[model samples]
Target: MSTDNKVPEIRSKGFSGEWAEEILGDVAEIKTGPFGSTLHAKAYVEDGHAIITTEHFKSGELPVDKKNIPQVSEDDYLRLKAYLLKVGDIVFSRVGSVDINALVTNKQEGWLFSGRVLRVRSGKIIDSEYLHHELSTSRVKKSVVSRAVGQTMPSINTEILKITPIHFPLDTTEQTTIGNYFQKIDALINQHQQKHDNLSNIKKAMLEKMFPKQGETIPEIRFKGFSGEWKNLTLGDLGSVAMNKRIFKHQTTISGEIPFFKIGTFGKQADAFISKNLFDEYKAKYPYPVAGDLLLSASGSIGRVVEYKGEEQYFQDSNIVWLKHDGKIDNAFLKVFYSMVKWSGLEGSTIQRLYNKNILDTEISTPERQEQTAIGNYFQKLDNLINQHQQQITKLNNIKQACLSKMFV
Candidate 1:
């Protein structure tokens, strides 16, 4: 098919039809919440009609507990009952850099929208689910924010919202099909996300139980073959730290062939780079990270680690700390043990930092080489599974975004 017409550039198979252009005022009734002063902090109470605000902008079923959201009296609710939300009504936050909206389900019926929100009732023209999905897409959201006015915090008025364009298929059945498809996708995304969270919690619990706590020589749990007290060792005993060479900002280039890595760029692509001459000169003389070594970030997110993967890169000085092993430790074993470590002297400190000397001086517990290898291998497999699940969720989300962009006009 040719691409010049109003037909979407891409869409789901078996439906080559195009969407029709419509305006928001033609298909929906738009209105803002009560006046700013009408709903104040003093209006909140222990129990009554729940006042939905930007905080509860998440569209879907509300939680059973409600988590102690502020409420209002019956009289106040009756007076502002005109602003009460019902099934199929979508509400948006009037202020904020990004446009935030929530679809009011049957469960959210009878809840009043606070002054900061704008409620849009799709009047028999557009499907509520489809409209919400359309508004959420980057295409429409950027348009919405572009019209917002402010120096620091951009905001939209109801006039700009009313004239906002809406484009979809003329057929209501087609609208429902698009809406239902996305609704199911959202549910699937939520399911995978919950599984990812559960797996992470399991790993954290295992890290706690399988390792020895402070002042204890033996772990609470161990592998099948291991049966004895763990060994005591300071970090210095495991390996010595190799510090990076001092490279000034002027020596680095924004666009260079050699990748110069800092603590910020560990595990990510390098934004800064050094000349080939500089890298080769430093690689031989200075104490630097090499293959089979673990890179420790000593600032910002202190103690974060990433292993050197034989990539061609030069490290930043003082910011990154690397371990030069002495054949007394396994890299995998050090990684797992580091995850369970609780750094001291960081409390109430303005700038959180872990100097190389302090990390080297910290005491740790360890098991025999065989047991350490087994435990490390097991967790590595578990981590691989976690990454797989998380990657699947990300892939699904990307599919949803691609569909939304092509399925709508």
Candidate 2:
């Protein structure tokens, strides 16, 4: 696993020569950021010169989002000019999350690094983007993190970073080619991420507009031919909170015939399980969620809603409850409504735990059943698109990791 090995297990076609190995110090100029005294908080201004902090490093790229970045006055920027970032410069976190690093592109050029960052500007020997991909490899990241010195809050210094070993092809063209290949993958990831974020924002907007604001009977937006003001009613008018019969600690096993979901794993994979005999008996006798029923988290991250598809799963009592409702409201409509509901206790206090009364008594303005179905169907389609984009992002990232492992020493 050492960089001393010149030939990687995988490489591009027409590239046969052994890769070169050298300590980072010999291939790049390493520098640390300014001291706290040199760059004080009071020196920052509304907007003048940007200062790159460890927060700016995300997905191995510098200044992922430039908005709201700390800025300094022109005079202060000149005083701390030595810490100025340049294109192709790579920055690393000096304290906490010491292994994370990012490459500076033209967008971040001339920006100054904050007190908690370390900078590495590459020499003529290595391609900066290629080195970024090299350092991003799991092997190099683990090495860097292991070298960082601190038990509670790991930190790295310029001296330690300088000695970090880096391996790369001798030819600059190969370096650029390899870098460019991954760059395209990263571009694709960013493109999908942008679409994901945009879709999420659109959903947010729709949620706000489609639901009635407090003190109002109608939402800002609605479906055609559904023009009348919505009905105002407490959740109790539609349903009551119901939960499964409790299964004590002894009744469950780590791995068993049926997956058991607790508050911690309400909408996720189950960590506990029950025997088939217990599941069959309890499901027959106890209050069980039917298909299309909305199973919700009543504790821990409260208000998380998941539509049950009649899966053979047992949920913990009280901690995960669902509304046993009449068919007045569509489940799809109710499911999305759960996303925006604000839980409050008696006497109008914000609740810590979602008591059954809190859920049943919460006031809501609901459209007629038909309009509810249309709104539900619309948001559901948007959610499906968002989920598809998210899945694509995850798949692309996995491919990137595989390439990073095989394409580098």
Best by lDDT: 2
In the order shown, the candidates' Cα RMSDs to the true structure are 4.0, 2.6
C-alpha RMSD between model 1 and the true structure: 4.0
Q: Clashing pairs in model 2?
A: none
The regions of model 2 sitting more than 4 angstroms off are 1-5, 254-256, 346-352
TM-score of 1: 0.81
Assess each prediction's global lDDT (C-alpha) against the native. 0.79, 0.87
lDDT of 1 by residue, 1-409 (tens): 1245667666555665656667687889888888768878787888888887766654333433345766889989898988998888888777773476667877778888888778899977788988988887776777888888886877776888887776776777777888899989987887887788888898999998888887888888888878888888888887887877888999999999799887778778899999998888888888876687788888778788888888788888887887787657777888887776777655336768877678878887878889888888878777888898899889998998888777766
Q: lDDT by residue for model 2 over 1-409, one digit each (tens)? A: 2345667877888987778889899999999899898888788899799998876774566655457899999999888889998888889999887888888888888999988999988889799999888989998888899899989989999998988988899899999999999889998998998899999999999999988898898889877788888899988998888899998999999998899998888888999999999999988998898899998887757788988998899999988888888677898888888888877752323634677988898887889889999998998999999999999999999999998888888
* Residue 314 displacement (Å), model 2: 1.9
